[model samples]
Target: MKITSIKLPGDISDESLEALGNDLENNSSTLDIEIPLNELQSSLELNNQQKDLAGQISNKAPRVIYSTSPSILVVIDGEPKIQQNAKWGVEAVVNTPFTLVKSGGSYYLHGGKHWYVAPSAKGPFSMTTTVSSQLRKIEEQSKAEASSENDAAEKDENTIYKIIVSTQPAELIQTNGEAKFASLENTGLLYVSNSSDDIFMDVDSQNYYVLISGRWYHSKTLSGNWEYAASDRLPDDFAKIPEGSPKDHVLASIAGTDAATDALQEAAVPQTAKVDRKSTQAEVTYDGEPQFQDIDGTELDYAVNTPASVIRWRGRYYSVDNGVWFESGRATGPWVVSVNRPYAVALIPPSYPVYHMKYVYIYDVSPDYVYMGYTPGYLNTFVYGPTVVYGTGYYYRPWFGTHYYARPYTWGFNVRYNPWIGWGIGYHYSSGWFNAGFGIGHRPWGYWSGGWWGPRSYRPAYCWSPNRYGGSYYGRNTVYYNRSRNYNIVNRNYSGNIYRNRGGIVSRDYRRADFNNDRYRNNRNPSWSANRSNNRYNDNRYSDNRNDNRNSRYN
Candidate 1:
């Protein structure tokens, strides 16, 4: 369905729009997003009040106004090390002596103030400096050690070599061997046998290694000189692998390693990484113009408005609240926190990214260490802009869209009328009434003294009753306002309704009705009914009284 107009509160600011646009532009390389100047301007105008409401909402603790991708952690030498892989350019282990630099599309590792170059991951390393002096001396002296002997045969007691895992794409190194090792579907870790198999190899920035044949063997390259490793010599990070991880299988295969593995696992798992599977279920409510699309090969319908907060896709209900995502099988959900967000979330149709881009989380790194995966076929089908292309789920589009309905008070802004633009001058909130102000004149008494009707008139019109609980009474082809609390009285025609504009929305409330409808069953006001059998003078007098009361109230 097309949304004709949207009414926003007056609090949203132009500055928020500018900042959002700037963020999108700055991250354009990683997130393939381009916001046309006109679109930005329009969104700013439409959501002018969002900024003011954001501050009010954010004051509540635990409310997240914005969210960034979660940090990635890779265990090294029995300790968990944070990894920064923003934009997927280079994965660098944080807070370590080692750093990675990219030149001409090739990555070089800098460790202990020395540059180690490798053509592809599998490398016979040669120490060289194609870089400047500042970087050459960029070493931490305390952490730095002298270069090791070139010959593999030579061993030094003082030289301690930490096993570095490779971050390069994992390959099926051995296919027909006694045991098969294949890359897991989403994680970079290699699965030794099957999904359930405990044996796995963790990937790091410079090396990929697995505990194989009861020995810790890691390679800087994909294929390796599977060097023998002493259990005590292994880096503390290696022990940080999770209980079910392929790295854990190393402990299972070897004796007396379980105790160490357990300790590392405890330290490896971050508090944030723990998924809260239980979540209180809430009804999914749509607040904006929801565009409905069918899920491929499913009877389910998916609805999205710009910055979609609620999504129904693939017969499942999904929603994002306060940066955490929840999912359920039904629209009215007993939701569970989604540990592994499904691929369907990333494929939430082009309309979502085109409008509500900020809520999009397709390329975010989840607690699972893998980037939230997307369907490459879906990305290929939807085009964000001419130059922006998401190739094979490797890229993402930056979040855009105004926070028009971002606040809790404004969360359920759904109205039946045109949502994109204003419905001609019948008080802004009148749009919520079904077919409000359409085809009908603003005159509660019908064509009064040559007043213009419908869209042609600029004069303020009264077409809806603001009382949400009030009922609309139809008699002799005319509509009357009936208040629930005062059933003894009825508003003849629409004259009792008061219209006032707040923000862009119009609110209508009815004055107390003095005349009882039951008493005037036979002689009801002519304006309240099509039949004018009642005396005109009596009707005119009542009309005069109502008009005087309305004028006095406004005055």
Candidate 2:
């Protein structure tokens, strides 16, 4: 059934209705559903993704497994890496995805609805009415810090979840109770409507299929010995999934489809810039001494301790900071900007954490400057065959030493792709999900010198911007600067230099005063609007879908 509108009870508080309206507006990709308030019963249900509304029909308590973070990976595959929160006088579970802390011989696992308590780290956890005040304070502080970004309503007391804790690579696949199937029109495939996961069953073999990071895995039943299914080799019925259908999001994962073709085209467009060799600088800071790890199957070693993507190739260190390439003789460098892309970088496999750096390309070089460009791949969006997917499907192991260093992950943050914003974390998953507790040094968890790498800062430019097509909250929105695709990078307001200089990196006495002229000449804010020509994907179909409240699944 096509979900065009949602019906609500008339008695809903104005504040609650307002919040819901704002949420639907922000996530406009989900079709416009009219929230009509009819006199109804006590319980309420809503599914914003599929635009489904099942309200006031029965008193059955709806249960959902809302994962706090996508697969929360702890270093080892067992008990989590626990650390002492001195101020709170409790041992905090620092590694796993959930908000778990221990005090007075009892461990508390904070779910969105209720706190589950157990005596040990491994628990037959049971629902608890009371918890330590310290745990309560920690939870409150987390919510307060995230208050600016998210105002997620709490789940009712009737909400239930089967708590599963693990340190290894694991995913939580859940249904309300039992799996329910709904058929796609004209296609012989049946999809699991009750679950958030992309699960489908083939009628012929009754085999179940799951899509993760552009790779499909199939099994005989819900619980199975799953095996890989190639996207190109998938059954022809997959291509029959309609354009505006509920399960149409999966089209991007299938090879040779229109959605997949669009994604590939987007990945080809690069964010280009020209840098001054003398003024632009680079630096690297390690947790301790510089440590190196081999990029399997390549003659390259990447710096493991620092957030910077520093590579050691043939005794020279190369780093890419905000799409500009820099090279130095020493590991801890007296560095200078470099024009040549490291040859070994191309050889690094996708499974490696820094593999994304391979996409950073050096386009041209002049006597005093360098021209560089990077595709969306540098920002963790990659072309997987005919499609572009977020993050390398491989999970790189995180490094934990004096300071914890997290690697880029494929899953966990509820990443969604859109033609307008590129890729962004869902609002429900974006806010305060990573800010659960402070890291060891009293800094934000996963803090790094480079903002975009790892969990240091999860805010993508588009998430906070008022405009629909992203903004300068990250750097110049790639689209905003595309008008000057051939312009020198220094002419723009780019703060990419890692080294701290006496009068800031861009010295006032610098000869090229014309570098500041572009802003005054154009009278355009690089952070905001762009010329219509620069917006390559300004198609009427996309605008019509947004303006008329219709569901057009382009991503």
Candidate 3:
């Protein structure tokens, strides 16, 4: 028997979900059904690779394990699961959306690990709630485009890409209405937010995954939990990891003190540089050991983009920590950088089955994806896209009960899950690596993938054209001088960002002057600099670069 949609009702906490956990061979609410006859007969023969390991994971009924416990851990358990092309040990569809679900009070979990699922994208971001879903997708946009117009358009300084949860998913919640729910998985791990007493956010203990250039590298933890050290921790020997030919084995290595940390060690990563990337802790070694070994020269002064100076938006600044849109100076803070991040988006886990709602961010908007926060273990459960409510969250190890009917829109690509922590989708180049197009898997392979060496430079010439609306808010249909159809405007007055299809312009000087020299050198305004050296800046348009993957973290 095939299962369609199953909804449970209650004031469930994430902790209860964790109690039941992933391997549900015992007491719990389960949706057991017979596999469809046609699907059973249609099971295709496995290739040599999967066939060799079939015995190890060979049960045939593809099942998605949802825990009702607060340790909300979601996954696809049992033998013979249908997920064949998972990049990380988990399995699920690629490029889809999920919603967050919430109700009762905040959810709770006791020990073990819990995963939550949000029903929409707008989020139910209360720390009191359980963690939720993740969205994954496979895209087919060609890595490189044939267009070779040596002369690109000049940029304006008013281009900005405001990244909030998509209105589409937000609308889903408004229309479908919200649901105070529970999961089918009985008694699983769940995590409850702190009760009336405020729990001090775990600055270091919370776990996170950071991906750079497609290659995933985890941080070294002194304890099982993260220490959240500034870049100053690296020894002076840090430098760039040399490019190794594909024939050479790189990406996954146990480099002693030799790995180059310059990119991460020497210079401070520019604010503009981190615009479209993700990073996570790799392996947990040297636990409880002194992590900072003073090579004397190894440690140096690192840079910090405080919530104070670094936070800006429109022509104003807003404190994102509390999600308040108040202008800068309105709320001053050296907001703690705990496991939680500022604007980059967050997600709930799928492993757990308890309710209430889960919150996460849309790090990559293209395929539309968000990774569940405070990742525990990389279990066999893969994330299946979410059902929208407030936002979307995918299921962990989704049951292969959904029909395999090919959608009218199909991306002919495959998912490859490796034990290695880093894995993502992107269009490819003749060269042997990938680029973290935008969000989702923010990092790419550093070697042959030719990781972005430094922060991208987007000046005035790359600013975007104003959207058809406006004229009321800013008092003009379009900023004057930028009337010319130039594509170089990069308005980063807020967080330093280099966005695509950016629009608008506000620089009077840029609008009037010839973008051909270096007379303008305002460290504050990057567009002014690009407007002068129109030569180098125009030559490298962001959209021009060849990003192989769908460019969407979740589609």
Candidate 4:
């Protein structure tokens, strides 16, 4: 006799379902329509008993176990289960499948036929509600499989990834304060960190798992929940962290006292230099006209000719064009013109300094000393040492603020106009000559000397080019320039071109009569002396190199 399908009452409990299956096998020889009828009557009785037990458990109200650490706990049916490991916060409970089920207001874990409740991923657990209908179906399916297959499925549930042993260390790059671990040698794993302190690398699908406090954890996504990994079952990567690597503590925990002393004694060096990784390129998206260029020092692709030329650098979007800077919180932007430039952009090294440096001088105004000819009240309290240091060559460290160091343009570059003071000049190197104004005597060879061609007594007027509707508002078209009685405003065009009020064309090549040498090579700006004096004023230790031409490209 063969039982094709067993149709039981819809309200039958999971326990009753299991028992009914058992009874069918036992009485197979005596199988008939009468056998199922007998078993159904007995199953109904057992279902009622299970319901009563469930009610009792619910009424008891799991007891809360308070822990000093961030972990929480509860007692269900007199069995204590921890939702979080006190040391590591949330962690996977032993023998519990790594599946989370959400019902009502709380999240529960499916432990075969049982349901365990926890406030979060890391849980102090307690057996609470009955198996949910969704979970019950899964459990029922598992029971139908053969015993050998069931055992194999159970083993697979505990295993996270297949381990592959490797001898080489994973190559890592630091960006946005997290280490990005990529397999440069094709170890076939990619991992990023959510926490700077707790970083792990995977190799051959195993090893180099992270151990925090004492518990082991693994994750596929950078910000994903760290599932508990058994220490005994951990892959070989954990054992391979070079002895002197910053992750030496992880090795010590795994290898115990038997860890190699030589590896531990190696000097701990911080990886400050940004590594060039092939996989770190930003995903580029074009909204309008397509313009492409490679941004130096980063894997970002930039659009330079677009109306709002944008580049994604270090996971942030920065648009630099038309002498104004804009930033966005996302990859695609309704970009906002940054009044005070972001600290992260200031930290960009010299390799990508052109775009950022063009605007750095605008923020150089201070109460005591005004570096930029305009914007009197806007002070630069963040930047330090615009000074030349001996060892690091040129240092512009931010001594005490959240601001990133915005280094002055110490290197020489030829341009007809002073980008620091002129508002109309497009900030690009190629566009500087076209928008040239009267020479401000702010030479590129060194710092600005106090002598600007514009009237010293004049106050700067904030001018903005017309927007799409031909109206002026603070935007990418805005610039701050000296507006005195001598220069009367003429008609302004819709394209933001300023025509001469007095009819004579504004000279593009207004060279300073006081300087005879070519503007490109000659250091005609008197500000170099002021910069030299100011450099010594901040730190007298570097006064000996006052005359040293080490930093000069001309020398």
| Best candidate, lDDT | 2
lDDT of each: 0.29, 0.53, 0.19, 0.28
Per-candidate TM equals 0.20, 0.63, 0.18, 0.18
Tens-place lDDT per residue, model 1, 379-440, is: 12112111111111111121112211111110011111110111111111121111111111
Candidate 4 lDDT over 77-127, as tens digits, reads: 111222332222233221111234344446555433345665653454566
Clashes of each: 36, 2, 182, 19
Candidate 2 local lDDT, 270-336, one digit each (tens): 5445567777775567888899998776779998887667899878888876666777888888777
- On residues 315-401, what C-alpha lDDT tens digit does candidate 3 reach at each position? 222222111111222223222221212221111122121111111111212121121111101111111111001101212221123
Task: Name the regions of candidate 1 deviating beyond 4 angstroms.
Answer: 1-99, 103-107, 118-124, 133-323, 326-555
In model 1, the worst 10-residue window by lDDT is 410-419
Which pairs of residues clash in candidate 2, taking residues 3 or more apart in a chain or in different chains?
70-412, 274-489
Cα miss at 293, model 2 (Å)?
A: 2.8
In candidate 3, position 367 carries an lDDT of 22
TM-score of 2: 0.63
In model 4, where do residues sit more than 4 Å from their true spots? 1-100, 104-107, 111-113, 117-125, 137-330, 333-555
User: Which residues of candidate 3, in runs, are more than 4 Å off?
Assistant: 1-243, 247-259, 265-267, 271-424, 428-555
Report the Cα lDDT for candidate 4: 0.28
